[model samples]
Target: MFLTLVLVVGVILVWFLVIGGVCSWVWSRLIACSSSWASPYECGFIASSPKFDSFSFTYLSLLVFFVVFDLEISLLLNLPERVVGFSSFYYYFLFLVVLSLGFLSEFFWGYVRWGY
Candidate 1:
């Protein structure tokens, strides 16, 4: 329990520090601007808009697919390192077949079909 808490806190702290540092560095250039200064300098043009636009469920589903597939591919890549044999190749091929079939099923169901 304590270890998880520490890890979570550490991650949040580092995330905040990195974001704050980058924002501070970016906005620091605006301090020397020659006009009414608030926004980041863009060679004399200041532009602003909503921080986040409208969200889409389709886009969200696509993002989830990307993450899940990426994680699976990463794990698949490690299979060769842990199990070195001809059977490992068979397992890898099987995994790929299953993954492809899963994606096709999702496509047929329109869970990740484009423009759906």
Candidate 2:
């Protein structure tokens, strides 16, 4: 118990130190700079007006689709180790079903559009 407590305290201390250092660095960079710091040259773009006219739903849809597909790939890759004690045939069947569902959803949603 003592060892575990020491380890946990060590971890907490390390994380606290890291966060404190980062906060100090950011504070110094943002506060102790000249007038040029407020300008757009420091990775900050100044605009006279709003940049976006209207939000496009397609971008959000594409982002959601990407996240879904990425998560599916991660889950699929980790399945073998997770289901090692289960029947292999069941695993393959479930994989096929998931893949088919993804393909059908993409096709039905017009996500597979072809253009020049």
Candidate 3:
């Protein structure tokens, strides 16, 4: 009990020295050469021209489909290790049915098509 108490007190002391009390004092005493650290451009003038126009929803949608299908493929890959009983098999089948339905609906809706 005494050792645990001493260790707890030491931890509390170290915690305060690390952050609880001395950290604010140290930051308050430090100084920066320039105050532009908070600005978007600290070392140079900010550019007025816009150059971020290459993004497209087509690529975003494709990326989303890739992620969803990749996740489903991973879950399918881990089938043997995860399925331990009838309940697990039932849930797995239910999951497969749900994903297949979603995929079929997407196919019928023209979302999943050639070149896409």
Candidate 4:
């Protein structure tokens, strides 16, 4: 028990020391570097024009939707085996059915047309 306690204390002390040192180093570096880092063209790169065209909202919305659904599918895939029984299989089947229906609707609406 004493050995375990000493080991835990030692680990905690080491972790805090390392984290504090890193934080101090990063803070000092940021403070010292900010004065010379504000200009956009500081690294020998010259800006030719003021600005270019902006991104479309449709593309951003589609990207967000893709990310949300991708993360949901990943989480569903990693569910515990004990919790994923026959009901989970049925749930997955229902999800796939809904997804397919949405895809078909989008296809019909020309939202998923091939090529730009």
Candidate 5:
């Protein structure tokens, strides 16, 4: 039993060490190959011209909200199989109400616009 535990721990440690080394080498290579220019520029285009556009806060907020909402939906979808009670429905309803409130606030603040 002791030998088995030691072997398992040793294998895990070696696996982590190998993974870390590989990740570090790849990160170093990427950094070395990157250009010195901070601003994004397209090849065959004037470097001085305005290049990459920044995402606005409205778009970012909507993206974050939708991602989180979808994650919540996926988590809740499994609840019916695992849980058997009215409590699950109550929690699901509460979550939907809160999510709706958030959507309303975002709409009022103009984070979610009509025209894409």
Candidate 6:
């Protein structure tokens, strides 16, 4: 047991030493100092700054609808081969009811509009 433990520790130590040595050598030889460069790259053109727009209500609603339907589909796909109980029917009915409610709510709230 002692021999095995020493062997494992020695192997791990050597592994770490090799990895650290390689990483340090690569860093020293290949990496350029950011201060020596004008930009992130050698290009002269300044790239446009990234646009950071907040998600609109329509986009948020669509995202929520996608997630809800995706979850429902995944659950349905894993259903038992033979559903033989009132519980499954009850759950499925409830799910459909919830989906219908969501659809109606989105329609009434103008989240389903595509005339933008």
Which candidate leads in lDDT? 5
What's the CA error at residue 50 for candidate 4, in Å? 6.1
Ten contiguous residues minimizing lDDT sum, candidate 5: 36-45
Clashes of each: 0, 0, 0, 0, 0, 0
Candidate 1 vs candidate 3, TM-score winner: 3
Please give the range of 10 consecutive residues that has the lowest summed lDDT in model 1: 42-51
| 1 versus 5: better lDDT goes to | 5
Question: What lDDT would each prediction earn against the true structure?
Answer: 0.78, 0.75, 0.77, 0.76, 0.81, 0.79
TM-score of each: 0.46, 0.49, 0.49, 0.48, 0.50, 0.57
Q: Candidate 5: give the clashing pairs.
A: none
Question: Over the stretch 69-106, how does candidate 6's per-residue lDDT look in tens digits?
Answer: 99888877856654686778678778989988989987
Model 1 misplaced regions, further than 4 Å: 1-37, 40-54, 79-83
Report lDDT (Cα) of residue 92, candidate 2.
59
The regions of model 5 sitting more than 4 angstroms off are 1-54
Model 5, TM vs. native: 0.50
C-alpha-based local distance difference test score of model 4: 0.76
Ranking by lDDT: 5, 6, 1, 3, 4, 2
RMSD of 1: 10.0
Top model by TM-score, which number?
A: 6
The deviation in Å at residue 43 for candidate 5 is: 12
For residue 84, what is the lDDT in candidate 4? 48
